[model samples]
Target chain A: MAKFSGVWATFEYLDEMSHAVEKIREKGKKPTVLSPCPRHEIDHALGEPQTRLPFISLFAGMLGCLTGYSFTAWTASDWVLPVSGKPIVAIPPFTIIGFELTILFTALFTLAGMVLLGVIDTLRHPLPPAVKKYTRFQRDRFGVVVDCDPAQTQDFEEIFKSYGAEEVHIENN
Target chain B: MSGTTFTYGKINDDMLRMLERPHPSYFLLLLGFLTALGLGVLSLAVQVNVGIGYSGINHPIAWGVYITNFVFWIGIGHAGTLISAVFYLTRAPWRTAIYRAAEAMTVFAVMTAGLFPLLHTGRPWLAYWLIPYPNQRMLWVNFKSPLAWDVFAVSTYMTVSILFFMIGLIPDIAILRDEAIRKGQKLRAMIFTPLSLFWRGTNYQWMHYMRAYLIYAAIATPLVFSVHSIVSWDFAMSSIPGWHTTIFAPYFVAGAIFSGLAMVMTVLIPVRVVFGLEDYITDHVVQSVCRVIIFTSIIVGYAYATEFFIGWYSGSPFEKAIFYFRPFGLMEEWTLTGEQSIGFPQIAFFLMVFCNVIAPIPLWRWKIRNNLVAVWIICGLINVGMWFERFNIVGSSLQREFLPAAWGSYWPTVVEFGITVGSFGFFFTLFSLFVKALPPMAIMELKEAAHPPMKKEAHG
Candidate 1:
């Protein structure tokens, strides 16, 4: 009997990999699909919820707009040195500043949100040693990791092999 | 191999191989650019030590080649964003193979453009005074000025462009890292490991990455227009006869994309041949850029016609006088030097017309656009024309001011020419290193656009 933490399956074909993922879900087990590139089919097979990254960008953009406008206006009013007979707080020109800040904050926040989510997921489920050993997931192969009892590793391996997985192995942590 | 048969392994093998050590000729190219940049630095040092008078700029023409180059480089950056962000949003398939290099161009071009202002100010160290920072002096920048708007617009554009470019490179860098690790190259792995940001290509990473990338495209699309619009406002907001026109914003935006696309082709065509990336950057990609140049050329031509019409129709003597001076101001006495020579304005105006409006027309013919040699020549001419376009806008108008007494023909000195050539050196040197250092093509996105390797062929 083999003592293992999980089972890893690698596939060269997107269709085979996606089908294997569907089978894992049908067996009431969660599996994470890995690939060199994002696939619409794999995304559909995973059935994950829509990402909330946009809301993060939107909120930050609004905050940035307020900050840009208020900062310019506050600094302008602080010195009341009117020039060219224009108002102390001009809205038209300041709108350009506000618009630029809105984009700047939106892009930065979106990137930060992505890094944060990636880090959180990485912390929760550290990559297995086998993943480090076999890096095809970052190059060409599509991979799925299924956690199961040590005794059931064979069963998962059989399921993966049946769905055209090129390699199946028991990953010990 | 055929396009449909391109597998993931082949894509990796092809792109990552570019990262290997380059030929000695690559270093020679880099050295050439560095030499140019050194000359520019020396000229700038001399100017700073002596005075700003080393350049052609004076009382009437306070803005000269530096401002022209500033606008030219900024305009050159626009097409990169347009290609990367705008094409992405539109789902243009051809963009995948080219967007990575284009985005890199945008960042480098903007960085090159940013240097002009610092150089022009003479006191580059005190350039921070333009920023709206809290200080003991309590001197706030005048918010009403277009120059103030430029500080925010350009800085924000630079920051956002860099972020966008870095985000796009994440997946590609991950591939490079993993390849290095697999090959047991300790040093390369060490360098790329952190740059990849620990991307393991999990479903979660892809989901969030795709969403965020789309949002970045959305935000950057507007910047493609706004940045150049703000740049044009530096001239438009002025009450000068030729600069104060409502058409300046759109006209400048169109010209920016036009010149930017030309520059992309100008670089990419040679790169494709030298790198032997004929499969990736194909004739189809070159043709697409040529078509865009044709469309933009028409808009630029129309804008030229409209400027002349408005000058004649508005009945403003100053506008008509400046418009006349642009193409017909050959009077030797009109020059500040008072030498018996042709003025720079007329020469630049006609050359601008010949290169920008006339040269690109042949691209409309499929045969000409497909010919790489012809396309390359046309692109080069467009670049030259766009620079003159800026020169015409900045120089000609300032030369023929409302009061002829205040008008002067600005002649560029060797130092100004050196600095101008040096800016190109700076851009090319950074870009030349970038091509060897990073994946010039978007590896992951190219795979996405291609057929996925399958047990069986599945076509969408």
Candidate 2:
């Protein structure tokens, strides 16, 4: 993650996250770039692709509509006999319940999906040393982590410096 | 004391401190509540022991006190939506001081309004039968009936009101959560717990919340228009001469808002003074609302003329005679109260016109509109006049409904009169309590009112 920060990384380093895999191939270590609400072409820069939300919400909403409509219709028709000549399964009357249930399920599922996605409810992320040093991501600084702790003496710094690296902050993970 | 300086938020804190202790204002309010509550208790006792006959609703007008109070309180409820949404949209700064109380007024007045149709029902226990649900009795209510429409209209309106109120309370609940953490206040935390719903104040949560609230507001806009339109349709759909008119949908909506704004102005002027919120609720806000008042005043005037023209143009003898009887028909033939009935009850006629139409003309002239004294008096007149308009429309119209044999009248009985006043007390009592518990304004809106929009966020 530190390998993807902008503040810790130089212009050449910015190009590393921009052209993340290229630098990763150069470094002999692969890296992944992330975009929740994309800054723009960041995914394209990293060559990763994705789509919005789960198809499950649409299915849930459809199911809810059918359930609501059928319940209202059944109750009016089969469950009780008509006193007058009025139709037992009046679709117009059941439309209200159907519409309300559709919106309700869509809203409920979207909220559940966000929680499951770990968007904001990051309750227990332990702070790694490198991530702690780069907590400036919370504010204005955007720098990419090179994944090399530098403490490893893993020769990663040499590989990073080769990519026009301005400065390297070791991530103590 | 008359010309002292104070901060806006500071006034609430100071008032709270005084209120927490034994202050004169607190004692006065408490006394007022107790007195009104006593009246309510006594009235309820009579109502429970006796019957609906205790009310002034009899003969030609089977709806009197309860209905009058119903319109009055529902009109009161209108002011809340205006304060919360309308004034917010218009950038009325004065809304800060009064919006919360007005919303509270909305909830309590709705409660009061909900009671009327039930109270009007002689056997109140059978009221739940109005809900169109399956039952063992194998009975179904008429879906086409206006009363059924009223049931749906009121139910939908109340639901929307509650949603609007709860959404507005979310940020304030967060504020309380923060305060509770700082002070380790048990009561504060308990109140905030459910309302906060584990809000983390994260940017994502705020974005979602903002989107939901905006969607609800957009949804509520039409609900506000339709709910009142349906309520008005209750009368217009009927065959009661003056009540039956195509103009009513708009006319009733206009009248409701017209009366609603006047009520807001009256309530705010005194409230701003007591709460010392002059800076936030400035003369500009009053004038802004008065602008709406003036526009609607003209519409109401046009409605009056349009009704008369409609009667004359259509040449419906019944409609024509109803209008003619209002101002010129013989007293021997047409009945009204007292010798005042002789030449049209000029008092009732002029009172409605003067208050609804004429009282707001000075608003077109900027100086008088902005003048606090003049504006307050006019607001008072508007309140009086709007009530009289309803009385004339409901009372006078129903009193004569085309059939001479069914042409008796109405006056409020003691129980009916007491309950009406009690409802006012109920509304204000809730409003006062809300002021102490919550930030009276939408803080975000107030902040926006002070500043311009921010640039869109970029994750980078």
TM-score top scorer: 1
Cα RMSD to the true fold for all candidates: 2.3, 8.8
lDDT of 2 at B228: 66
Q: Which residue runs does candidate 1 get wrong by more than 4 Å?
A: A1-4, B330-339, B457-460
Q: What is the TM-score of chain B alone in each candidate?
A: 0.97, 0.87
Model 1: per-residue lDDT, tens digit, A1-173? 22338898899899989888988889888787789999888977887647778889999999889988998899889988867697888898889888989998998899999999877766655556677668788889998988787887888999999999998888764
What local lDDT score does residue B314 receive in model 2, on the 0 to 100 scale?
80
Model 2 lDDT tens row, B1-460: 1112332233323433322333478558867976786787688678866988877778878767677667766766776776676655665556655566667667777777888788778777889988867778655554445676567667656766666677666655655554565467778777876785544433334444545544444445555566567777678878888789889888877887788778777767766777666666777777777888898889989999998899899878888877876655455734466554443233456788888888788888989987888988998898778777766677667777777887775667789778867766776666666666666654434432332111232224
Error of 1 at B350 (Å): 1.2
Candidate 2, true inter-chain contacts retained: 0.00
**What's the lDDT for residue A121 in model 1?**
67
